[model samples]
Target: MALTLTCERQGGNYGPACAFSEILALAERRWHEWFSQAPAMGGPYRDQYYYAWWVLANNLVAPFGQLRHEALVPSKKQYIGVWNW
Candidate 1:
C-alpha cells in the first residue's frame, strides 16, 4: 500500500502543478542543500547527529503572525509551541 499527503495554506492559491516524482526530487535536492552545511561527525553517533539536525529542520517554522523571527517548535505533532530558552 502507498499513500501520499500534501498540505497548503487554506485560502491560498494552489501553486504550479508538479508530478509526484518531481516533487520528491525537489524535496531531495532541498534536503541535500540544507544537510550539506551540517558539521561533519565521524563516529557511531554520526547517524544520531544527523537525525537531530533533521528533526530541527523539519520542525522549523517561518516567522508569521506575532512570531518575529524564524523559530523551531518542539515537535509538530506533540508540541506546537516555540521556546525562547
Candidate 2:
C-alpha cells in the first residue's frame, strides 16, 4: 500500500523494488490496538482504515518526487476522517 501510494503521486515512478511491507504491518498493529481499546467503534474494519491512514500520514516522510507515476498524493480530505477520531 505504501508503494502504491507513492506510485500514485504526481510524476512519480516506481523503483525496481521498494520496502513497503513494514508500513502495512505497522498500520495493522496500530489498528488492532486502537479498536481493541475502542469497542464503541464496533469494527468491520472501519477503524482500521482510518488508523492506517493516520499511521501513513504520521510516518510516511517520503517526498512526492520520489514516488511512482501511479502514486497518490496525500489529500486533505483523506486525512480528515481519521484524524478527527
Candidate 3:
C-alpha cells in the first residue's frame, strides 16, 4: 500500500493543475538542487547529515503574513509560528 498527497495555499486563485507524477518529479529535482548547494559532508554519517539538512529545508517558510523574511522553524509539526530572537 502507498499514499501520496500534495498541499498548496491558493490564497484566492487556483493555479494551473499539475499531474501528481510531474509534481513528484519537480520536487525530486528541487531536492537535488538544494542538496547540491549544501556543504559537502562525508563519512559513515553522510546519510544522517543529509537527513538533518532535509529537516531544516522542510521546515523553511517563505516570507508571509507578519514575517518579513524567509525563516526556518524548529519543527513545523510543533511550531505554528516563527519568532525572531
Candidate 4:
C-alpha cells in the first residue's frame, strides 16, 4: 500500500539489484541467527521466518532508533510507536 507508493515517491525505488545486495548483506551478517537486540530473537537455528516482516516497519528511515542504526533528533513532537510509519 503506502510502501509501494512511498518508494516511487522517493524519486525511485532502491531497485532489485540494491535490494538483493541488502538481502545478501543480511545473510552475510548472519541475521538469521540474530536479527535484533531482542535476545528472544537470537538463537543457534532461529527460524527467522517472522523476522522477514520487520522490513515493513519504518525501522530504516529515522532520527528515531531501531536495530543497529540508533540516533535521535530532538523535537517537540513525540513518536510513541510505529504510528509515524
Using TM-score as the measure, which candidate wins? 1
Task: Report the lDDT tens digits of candidate 4 across residue range 1-85.
Answer: 3532212225445554446566567665655544454455446545564454344232434542353454333332465443331
User: What lDDT score belongs to each candidate, Candidate 1 first?
Assistant: 0.78, 0.52, 0.79, 0.44
lDDT of 2 by residue, 1-85 (tens): 3534332424555555435786577668877785566435446987787776555545434444554333333454545322121
Pairs clashing within candidate 4: none
TM-score of 3: 0.66
Count steric clashes of candidate 4.
0
- Listed in order, each prediction's TM-score against the native is 0.67, 0.29, 0.66, 0.21
Question: Could you give candidate 3's per-residue lDDT for residues 1-85 as a string of tens digits?
Answer: 8975554546845466668888899899999999999999999999999999999888777754667777778785766776454
lDDT of candidate 1 at residue 26, scale 0 to 100: 77
Q: Please give the distance, in angstroms, between residue 73's alpha carbon in candidate 4 and its true position after superposition.
A: 12
RMSD each, Å: 4.2, 10.0, 4.0, 9.9
